[model samples]
Target: MISTQKSFEKKEQGSLYLVPTPIGNLDDMTFRAIQILKEVDYIASEDTRNTQKLLNHFDISTSQLSYHEHNTNERTPQLIEKMLNGQSVAQVSDAGMPSISDPGVELVKAAIESGITVVPLPGPNAALTALIASGLTPQPFYFYGFLPRKKKDLVASLVDLNKREETLVFYESPHRIKQVVEQMVIVFGAERQIVLAREVTKRFEEFVRGTAPDVLEWLENEQIRGEFVLIVEGNSDIEEEAPQSWESLSLKDHVEELMENQDLPSKKAIKEVAQLRGLQKREVYAAYHEINE
Candidate 1:
C-alpha cells in the first residue's frame, strides 16, 4: 500500500509537478492534476488564455506564467530559481501533458539539474487516445510528434520509417492531412491501414479508419476541420508476397517497367531494378540478352 502522508511529507523543495490537462473534454482532467495545480505556488502554461479557461472551469485561482516554446529558454532558469527558493511549481500545456508534444521538457531538465523533484500527473493525451481507438496494433507503437512540411522531407521521413514494425503515430493539422496521406500512400503503399482521429473529445469528434488511399479519398469529400492524430500500421514480415508484375518477368522487363511506368532512362532503370531486386549485374545482363535475342 502507498502512504499518501509520507509521500507528501517527503516531497522535496523546489519540486516541479508536470500536470496533464484535458486534450479536449474537461471531464478527462484527473483529480490529482487539479489538486496539484491548486496547491502549487505557480503554474507554467503554454497558452495562458487557454489554460485560463480550464482554470476558470475548475474554479482554480492559481497564478500562471507563460512557458511556451518561444519563451522557454529565457524563462526556464527563472522558473528553476523559484523552485530553488522552495516553491512548488506545476507545468501544464494548453492541453494534454506538458512536454509530451508540448513545451515543458526544457523546464523539467532545468529543475532536475538544480536538484528539484519532478513528478508527472497523467490525465489525457490525444496521441494515446487516438491510438486506442485506431483499431491498429497497440502494443508496439512509435510516436512521431508531427510530420515534416516539405514534400521531399516528408517523403524521405516516411521512407526511412517504412522498415519499422511498430505502428506510427503523428499529429497533423487538417490543412496538411490530405497531402500527408497522399505521400504516405506513395511511400508505405496504398493498401497500408491508416486511422485518422479528428477533433477528438469535441462535439465534432470523428475517427476515419481504412487503407491509406481510401482515407485520403474520404477526406477529399469532407470539409477539413480540427487537429488530427494519424495512426499508420507498419510493415508486416509475414504477409504473402505480392504477385510479380510484368516488370518482374526478367531484368529486361524490369527495365521496361521503369521506363514505361516510372519514366526512367533504360540504363538507369536497369541499374535501379537490379539493385531493388537484389540481382547481380551479370544476371541482369543475361536476362536483358535473352530479351534482345
Candidate 2:
C-alpha cells in the first residue's frame, strides 16, 4: 500500500506558476514574476538563451528547460512528470504573458489535467499597451492576435471584421505592416481611422494615427521598422451617405452618384442605403428591381 505521508508531501510541493516577461522594455517585468522565477524549482522557457538574458538581468539563477512550439509536445509530459514528482515549476514565454498568442497554453492544459495548482502573474502585453494609447474607442474591442499573411485570406478576414462594430487590434511584423495597411484601405475603406504603434514601452515608442489611406501613404514614404501593433476603428454611427443630389434619383442614378462620390460598387451602394434606412438588403434589392422592372 502507498504511504499517505508521500502523497501529502507531493501535494505541498507540486504547483505550476505562469510568469510574464517584459515584451520590449526590461523595466516592464513585474516584481511578483521576478520573485516567482527566482523561487520556482525549475522554469520552462520558449527560448533558453532569451530567458537566460532576462534571468541574468534580474539576477535569477533558477534552472531553465527549453519548452517551445518545437519541443512542447515531447517536453510537456516530462515537465508534468516533474511537477507530479513534487516540484514547484514556472513557465515563461520569450516575452509578455504566457499562453497569450504564445506557447504556454498546452502546458497549462496539461498541468490542469494533472490536478497541479496553476497560478498566473501579471506583466507586460504589447497588444493592450498599444490599444490604450491608440486614441480610438476603447470599450468592446476585439483582439485578433495576428492577421493572415496571404493577401486573399487577409482581405477576407478584414471584410468579415468590417461587419463588426468593435475596435480591432492585431499584431503585424514590420515587413508586413505596409501591405496590411494597404489592404485595409481596400477592405475597410480609405478613410477608416487606424492607429499604428511601434516599439511600445521601449525607447522608440511611436504612435501614428490617421485614416487608412493617409497612413498607407505615409508608410510608403518612410521605412517601416520594429514590431507593429495595429488598431482599426470600427463602423461609426454617422452614416457616410451618397450626395443629396442622388437622394431623389433612380436606383441606377444612385449607383452612379456613389461611384462619382465614394467610388463604390452598385451592391455596396445599395447595402449602405439599406443600413442607413434600417431595411434588409433584399428590400433594397426589390426597390432597385422594381425601378428597373
Candidate 3:
C-alpha cells in the first residue's frame, strides 16, 4: 500500500501535474503553474473555454480537453491511458486547485493507481485566502466547501459542526447566501461571530464582519453579488463530553446503542454505526437484522 513518487526524477510514465488557477485576480497565478500548463502535453480542464482564456492571456497554447463533473467518468480512463503512454498532463479547475470543490478526483486516483506521478503546484485558493483576512482565528480551521442545498440536510450538517472549536469556512453562491446565513443564525445562535468575504481577491473584494444576525440584517438590505466565503467562529462554550467507544459492543449492539442513545431511527442508526466502524451500510444493515425478515 505504500508508494513513493519522486516528482522531479525522470521516469517512464509522464507526470500528471495538478495546477492551481487564480480565484479571481490574474496576478495571483504562480510562475510554476503557468510553466506546467505550457509544458504539459495536455491540459484536462473543468471548462475548456474558461481555461482557454487563461491560456490565451498568458500566451501559452496548450491543447485542452474537457474534464468537468459531467464527463468525469468517461474522461478519467482516457486521461490515465495518456499518462501511462508517456504523455504528461496538467489538470486544472475553472479556478483554484483542481479537486477542491471541483472535478478531477477520479482522474487523479486513476493516475496514481496506474503509477503516474501527480505533482501538485499550489496557488490561489478562496478558502484559505478568506480565512486569513476574516479577522477570525486562522489556525485549525475547518473548510467545509459548500453546504447541502436541502434545508433538512443543511441544518443537520450545521448541527454537527456547531460542536467544533475551530473556525469553520464554507463556500456559497450568491443565490443561496441569504438562506444559508438565515439557517446559521438559527443553528449557531444569533450572537455567534461570523464573517462574510464576498468577491474575494477581486476588484470589489469586501468583508462583512459581525454576529450572525448582524450579517443577516446587512444581507437583507443589500444586493448580494459574486461568490462568498462564510467564516464562522467555533463553539467556545461547547461542553466537553466523553467519547463513545464501541469496542465492547457487537455490531448489532452498536447499532442499537446509537438508536437508543442518540434517538436516531433504526435506518439512521445503522448507517451511523456503519460509518463509525468503517463497514458497508448493507453489511451493518444485515448484521443488525440477523433473524428478522
Candidate 4:
C-alpha cells in the first residue's frame, strides 16, 4: 500500500493537477497555477459558469467539465477515463484549494487508486491566511474547515474540540457566523480569544480580533457578509499528566487507538496525537499512512 509520487516525472498516463484558484482578490492568483490551468487538456470545474469568468480574465481557453458535489459520482469516472487515456486534467474548486471544505477529495482518491500522478499546486487558502494574522499560536493549529450545520452537532463538536491545546480554525458562511460565535461563547467561554477574518484578500477584507463575547457583540451591530474564517484560542488549562503506556506504541497505532476509543476521524485523531507528542500533524499523518514524505 506504500505509494510514492515523483510529481513531475514523465509517465505513460497523464497527471491530475490539483490547482488552487484565488479565494477573493483575483490578483492573488499565481502565475504557475494559471499556467497549469492553461496547459491542462481539460479543467474540471466546480462551476463552469463561475470558472468561465476567471478563464476569461486570464484568457485561459481550456475546455471545462462540470464537477461539483452533486455531479461528483458521475463526473469522477469520466474524468478518470480521460487521464487514463493520456490526457492531463486540472481540478479546480469554485474558490481556494480543491478538497478544502469543497469537492475534489473523492477524485483525488480515485486518481491515486487508478495510479494517476496527483500533483498539488498550492495557492490561496483562507484558513492558513487567517490563522497567521489572527494573533494566535499558528503552529500546531487544527484546521477543521467547517463545522456541522445542525445545532446539536455543532455544540457536540465544539465540546470535543474545546479540550485541545492548539488554536482551532473553522470556516463559516455569512448567515451562520453569528450563530456559530454565540455557540462558541457558550462552549468555549466568553474569555477565550477569537478572531474573525472575512472578505479575505478582497477590497473589503477585514479581521475582527477579540474575546468570544466581544465578537458576538460586534456581529449584532454590523451586517455580516462574505465568507468567514474563525480562529479560536486553544485550551490553555490542560493539566499535564503522566505519559500513558500507549505512548510507547508506534505513531500509526497510536492514532488508530485514539480513533477507535474517542470516535474521532483520522484527521482529528492525528491532531490529538500530534499535540500530545509535540510533533507536526503532517509528520503523524505520514506515519499513519506509511507515506515516505
> Which structure among the candidates has the greatest TM-score?
3
| TM-score for all models, in order of appearance | 0.78, 0.77, 0.83, 0.81
TM-score of 1: 0.78
Question: Candidate 2, residues 151-249: lDDT per residue as tens digits?
Answer: 899999987888878999998899999999989998888779999998998899999999999999889998889989999999765455567664687
* Span of 10 residues, lowest total lDDT, candidate 1: 1-10
Which candidate leads the pack in lDDT?
A: 4
lDDT of the candidates, in the order given: 0.86, 0.86, 0.93, 0.94
lDDT of 1 by residue, 1-293 (tens): 43122224565466889899998889998888888889999999899999999999999999999999998879998899898888889999988888887898899878777768888776889999999999999969999988789999999999888878899999999899999998998889978999999988888899999999999899999889899999999888535557767544766777777789988877777777788788876667668667443
- Name the lDDT value of residue 18 in candidate 4: 95
lDDT of 3: 0.93
**Clash counts for all predictions:** 0, 0, 0, 0
How well is each residue in 1-293 modelled by candidate 4, as lDDT tens digits? 79998888899889999999999889989999999999999999999999999999999999999999999899999999999999999999999999999999999999999999999997999899889899999989999988999999999999999889999999999999999999999999989999999988888999999999999999999988999999999999876777887768999999999999999999999999999999999999999999998
**Which scores better on lDDT, 1 or 2?**
1
Model 4, position 199, has a per-residue lDDT of 86
Candidate 4 deviant stretches above 4 angstroms: 239-293
TM-score: model 3 vs. ground truth:
0.83
TM-score computed on alpha carbons, candidate 4: 0.81
Candidate 2 regions exceeding 4 Å error are 1-10, 237-293
Would you list the rank order by lDDT, best first? Answer: 4, 3, 1, 2
